[model samples]
Target: MINATILSMFSLSGLNDMTTKHRVTLFSFTLLCYCVILLVNSALIVTITLEEKLHEPMYIFLCNLCINSLYGTAAFYPKFLSDLLSNSHVISYTGCLLQVFVIYSYAATDFSILALMAYDRYVAICRPLEYHSVMTKHRVIWLVCFSRLVSLLCQAIVMIMTSKLELCGSHIEKLYCENWSILKLSCSSITINNIVGFIVIFFYFGHDLFIVCSYVQLVKSALKSREGRKKFTQTCLPHLLCLLNVTTALLFDLMYTRYGSASVPQSVKNFMAIQFLILPPLLNPIIYGLKLTQVRNSVLRLCRCRKQVKGLG
Candidate 1:
């Protein structure tokens, strides 16, 4: 077995082509984007928590969604900003594995949460009278916990499998550490890793299929009544849009990871690498904030209260 201690750090070669000027510009934009994500997501979470009227199953799930966005972004931005300012773009082996766990778990949790949201909509729209009984407070908490826990378990297994591999290289061509990138460095047969990875992907693919099926039934039932149609447009539309946004962002990253050509511009490749990390966190809250009437009103009310407090001061 190759000694794991030999590969202490992995050089991130993706940033090598950037000049000092470009790095500073990229840093400024990234910082601004990260701040916006934090502000919007935190605002939504706080709004949902404080407003007793908004403490229903739908809003609670929305709160968890925002929290997941924040969790995912925290894994990327701090280290990314530090790297942009540093001379060497390298991450320690342990740190790389940790990043893989956090980032992938965040993504998996997102899918889990979205799937739950789809079910919530299904019950709320398809069985309005039974919705309260079906989505009770205890059940909501259990569902939320299940979403987070399953993701953590899956990603932890991936991380464990990756850590056991003896790496032969210390260079990662991407901007961030991912399981596949680390797997590429393995000196031994990665058949087991590949199998486990495929299993995880297929499991989450099942989540996507579930969401799609849920929506299919929802749309069919919703079209029968004007009231149902309005409810679907008011609430389900935002969820659908957010789902599309994240799905598209992830597709870009996956395509680039699998089929990216060296002949492609480094800037384009870098954008693809970070698109999922950027667009979903930034867009989810915005889509929900503008689309969900309850959330929109709560946010406005909170803002107005803040302004009144400042005036009183």
Candidate 2:
């Protein structure tokens, strides 16, 4: 009975009533942004992978950050670009659920990896002698897998719960699928879903708290020595910037989606809806590439080698 009541398709209002000219322009700009995200992130991932010097734990985590940006954006950009060109903005129920899972899991994995990076930095700076033994190749792999698997499981449960929803409505006010939007369509009580959702939210919020505590200890340790301060300034700054970028973007998205003023302009509303999709994926790689000296040198070396090969060909 519940399965029968679930809507087969969802109607999205975010792109409705756009003029033909506006659609074309929006499509072009969005396409450009997606390409840049792919190019920059892929370049960074390639640089880190090909450069043996970047095989350390910090660089490996940075590589995961780049890869996750690609992973997350791949879920949104293609579908969004298609919606921009299509007359009807609709999605199948299964497709919506998959999108929700990929996107939120991307977020979960991002926070997880960033938290791990904070710990890596703490060990390198605060406990220099034990850094190698603690952040070994096997250990890093295990940590990455554990974090991602836990996130996937949590999101899987949420999606399973969402799939059971007996939707009374089909219209979604936003451009894409999200947990809150899907939950809003349910015809019956959603206490269980809400509870599970908050549990997941707090779980990732705990990542933020962990990062803060790690940094607090780092600050104290770094202040004790000039070398410690320099090390923190050199490597840890990029992680902090990336963390701030992602967390702030997420906060903006959540705040606007849940409690934002409807009186705000539609364009602004749209930006708030997609800011996370745009900013973090685009900025994370760039922050690391520019701020980390080793990464900068490695990327330059990679680019020069590419040019030499091209000339020979």
Candidate 3:
């Protein structure tokens, strides 16, 4: 039935009929939004890092969040925008591989960063006495480095392993480089490849969940203090929401792979795409500025300074 439906759709649209204008329009709009998001995120990171008053674990974690979101957006947006603006759907073999590698690399790093941020919050709120020692600048730097390194290693292994296979065709149905779609195009036996993909997904999701849950438990313990409970919840809510977004998206991807197309509705898929790509970057700064008084003041100050400079100029 799936094959018949695909054949019917192909017959209607014609296999070679390339009316990609609509797709290009959608990509263009998304790309513009992402560019704005990247700019704002970068500004926030600069503010946090250069401003002496913003030097704390909370702001440090915000800096990491901004950096991770930038990396994630960078991995996918350049190629997407190129394809959109130029109407060039023809990605080179190497380009496709690089996209797959970079996308997953940043994705893994993003997840790791969220986990570390959760840990930071847990330490800051729950173990206030030892927060500074526990979340030292050196330690955070090492964790960031280690997170990206591990992601790179995983992506390297996947790329090397997949490179050995002969591709049957280049008819990737999806708009972007997805592992399952690429794997489906290979003429070679993909049993081992599929197995590896499953294992990677399992470990990635399980480990991230474990880390996040640990922080949740720690937050629970901290919330027992009546004085800190309200502040702690306010501080942690945004991160919790962001973590939930990531986890749900990963779970949906896994379910889609396991059950094929029937696993999830198309609406759910579309919503997830928007949530992952569009929502988080917009939310992070707002969450910080609104939840924390200092960030709001800093942003207001920056705005006033910019206006003053513009008036003088």
Which model scores highest in TM-score? 1
The ten-residue window of minimal lDDT in model 2 covers 1-10
For each candidate in turn, the TM-score is 0.97, 0.96, 0.84
Residues 8-50, model 2: lDDT tens digits? 8888888775788999999999999999999989989999899
Ranking by lDDT: 1, 2, 3
Candidate 1 lDDT over 126-229, as tens digits, reads 99999999999999999999999999999999899999988888889888898888888888889999899889978986888999999999999999999999
- Candidate 3's C-alpha runs over 4 A off are 1-28, 85-88, 262-275
What are the lDDT scores of the predictions, listed in order?
0.90, 0.90, 0.68
What is candidate 3's CA lDDT for residue 230?
70
Model 3, span 90-155: residue lDDT tens: 666676778678767766776777777778777777777998899888988788788778888988
Which 10 consecutive residues of model 1 have the lowest summed lDDT? 1-10
Better of 1 and 2 by TM-score: 1
Clashing pairs in 3: none
RMSD score of candidate 1 (Å)? 1.4
